[model samples]
Target: MDTLHIVCPACQTTNRVRNDQLGAHPDCGRCKQPLFQGRPVVLDEAAFERQRTRSELPLLVDFWAPWCGPCRMMAPAYEQAAALLEPHMRVAKLDTEQAQALAGRLNIRSIPTLALFVGGREVARQPGALTRADDIVRWARSQLATA
Candidate 1:
């Protein structure tokens, strides 16, 4: 069976998981913490880069500022989407307010932007809030499908 490198959200350790075991509730080799938490992991610039570059799985990032009302409104929906997408992909949130340089590097011009990454490269980007979980999932999946 093929294996993939998954970055542990808890410990930042890299683990190898079999292709067939992705949905089997795999644990991190180093931290023994569940790899898929069914929720989005909060990320800093370093953590974001590590997961993006190291993991074989696709990454969905929500870039938002704390003061942005649209971002606050979309948080719950993003959380719901995380629950649905985990085990197949990794979901994370990056606070653009805290990581201004990183946000600038990504050219994030708007709050509540969603970017999907595959193999360390951005595959698609959507700006503005997606207030529904289904919409977020549908958009991410569509982008991944095309990628």
Candidate 2:
């Protein structure tokens, strides 16, 4: 059977799940937390690295800072995009303030940047706050198609 590697949001454990079991709401082997929660997972640098490198699923990371107005404004739309995109793709958020070094390494020069990673490499990046859920979904799908 084909399998997909999914990183647990709660514990950052990489779980090997059969592709057929994705819709069954697979739980983490290490933490037993549901894998797809219909919301963006908050990731620190370590967890972020693990998920970005190990998971077979495409990872959509929202680079945001707590104090940025546009970032705060886009949070709800990002959450909605998570609801629509999960189980096929993984959506995560990294607080730029908390992951300062990681942000610098990624060369993030703006708030509310959206970067899509597939197979451990960044395939596309958009620097700005996206306020509409449909727009976010559309952009992600388009990028994945081209990727």
Return model 2's CA RMSD, one decimal: 0.7
Clashing pairs in 1: none
Cα error of candidate 1 at position 128, Å: 0.4
Clash counts for the predictions, in order: 0, 0
* lDDT digits (tens) for residues 53-144 of candidate 2: 98999999999999999999999999999999989999999999999999999999999999999999999999999999999999999999
Each candidate: what lDDT? 0.95, 0.95
TM-score (C-alpha, index-matched) for candidate 1: 0.98
Worst 10 residues of 2 by lDDT: 5-14
Cα lDDT of model 1 by residue, 35-58, tens digit: 999999999999999999999999
Candidate 1: 10-residue stretch with minimal lDDT: 22-31
The C-alpha TM-scores of every prediction are: 0.98, 0.97
